[model samples]
Target: MNILIFFPSIDNGGPTNVVLSLLKGLNKNKNINIHAVYFWGDNDNNLDVINSCCDSIYKLDKVNLKSLYKLLAIIKEIKPDIVHSHCLVPDFFNYILSLCYSYKSVSTLHCNLDEDYINEYGFIKSHSYKFIHKYILMKINNVVSVSKSVLKAIPEVKAKTILNGIEELKTPLYKDNLDVINLLYVGRLIKRKNISFLISCITEINKIRNKKIKLTIVGDGELKSILKIKSGKNISFIDFNDNPFACGVENTFFINPSLSEGMPIAVLEALSLGLPVLLSSIPAHIEINDKMTDGVQLFDFNFESINNAIESMLIDCNNIGYRNKIKSQFQDNFSLNTMSDNYVLEYKLMLEG
Candidate 1:
């Protein structure tokens, strides 16, 4: 079967990585012919990885009226059995294209659109975009959400919860050094991610402990410059690493104090690599934390709560046995093969209908 994966752009985040994981997993099927199109310019490194997974790749100079026509032309030429899109813009565009063509289309919700939009833009603009999105989504074939929280948030539009998955390594990476506890945060430095909150907590921890704890942030965004100024010597920033699972092995713990999330791929990748996690008490994080209790800790989106959670992690950072147990639980539940198989089934079902 021919499948066209449409994305707004290739960026350093969970959504892009999730799409890449799907492409890699689906490519294993001999009958599947995968083609991917990006609405905007590509991230060179991510594009190279995507090129290896897809049979063909197409990129529009930018998302505009001309690009829309070009996208439609490519869709007509490809004549794919299914068109799967990620993010709001791409999903809406695919819905528009579906109106003109007779092909099955599916969209994956990467976050709670309502909250995300309001957090980025103000309430009025967010609500306006929400109305537009709801209108377009109502006409889409199928909607898949990465977390139950996202599906619940969009009750107006029907959606299925399909949690993001990562590949399970044959041998999990084990951190050898236990003297200095390394805490890792892997995602964009956006306001909603609460990167500043994380920095403050780390700063507080350093004040309590004499540089025994270190935070390694592994992503960049708009707040990079401001965050660097706020961060001290205990905290260090690194460019986004596509293979976070490999990086997780070098760290003692993973922490995400984001205000909101939709089954964050970084958290999943970290858990799969046997890194204990300290997450905010968001619905998505709670859903995952409920499954296992030993190596994962959840805190509210406050400085006091974050400071307490970090202290707890520092105390238990030497517990290798607990961390391994978390890895075993993650392996049993979230797997790249299982996620791809479910999407393939969804595509078949949509086509049959």
Candidate 2:
């Protein structure tokens, strides 16, 4: 079977990581031929990693009518059995291809489209994009969601929830003899992530407790500079690192106060590395917390709730037994192999139908 995966780029962030993981997983199947096409962004370090997994890779110059025609030409030439898309541009392009071709198409909804649009372009423009997005989603043959929250948000279209997965690290790292509770936030420093709320909570945590906590913010984005200026002495900002599991190992807890998410891969990596999580009560985070009851704690996206969650965590920061249990559960259920198997089954069923 020939499978072509499409994405805007494999530069960075959760969605890119998801596609990369899927590539790594699917490549293990000898019966499948893997091909990938990406349209935008420079060939960063990850491009090499992507190249290693696929039989062939295609990169288009841009996303325009000319580029679309070029992509359609390539699809006609390859005649892949399935075209799986990770984001909007690729999904739209694939949908158009489906209209003129005979290949099965699948799209993974990685975020809440309405929330993403409103955040990026405000209320008025968001409505127009939402309409366009829904139209394309309806046209696509199969839709997969990274989290149930994302699936529920798109009520107009039917989608299956395939929880994102990660490879488990062989040797988990731990911060030994830590004087303070080490907290970590690993993802884009963006408005949807609510980095500002995390900074404020850290500030409050430091002021109220005798055993003061420290937070290391990993990953860079548009809000990085502004967040650095607003952050308290207790917080430290770092650029995006390719290995979040390595960074997470030295921390006591993984915290994400994001306003919205689609089963964040960073949180999964953190849990895989045996770190307990303190997350906001967004539907995605809540869903994770529900599955691993002992391993995660949830709070509202406000100061009061975040402050309370931090205080609760500080009381038992050294719960090694609980952390280990969470890690075991995550390994059994959310491994890369499990996710890849599900996708392969889905691909077969789609083709058979």
Clashes of each: 0, 0
Tens digits of per-residue lDDT, candidate 2, 1-353, equal 99999998778877888888899899999999999999766646778878888999988877899888988888888889999998778888999889899999999999888777788778998888778888899889999998888866579898888888887755557555567777888888778889898887778767765556778899888899999999878788778766654654454788988888888998888888777789999899988877785668889867778777866766645575876787788977678888888999999999999
- What are the lDDT figures for the candidates, one per model? 0.82, 0.83
Model 2, backbone clash pairs (residues 3+ apart or across chains), number? 0
Q: For model 1, how does the per-residue alpha-carbon lDDT over 159-256 read when each residue is reduced to its tens digit?
A: 88777887765545666566677888888899999999888877876786555777888888899999999999878888876565455455577888
Alpha carbon lDDT of residue 128, candidate 2?
A: 83
Candidates in order: C-alpha RMSD to true structure: 2.6, 1.9
- lDDT (C-alpha) at residue 141 in model 2: 94
Question: TM-score for every candidate vs. truth?
Answer: 0.90, 0.94
Error of 1 at 79 (Å): 1.5
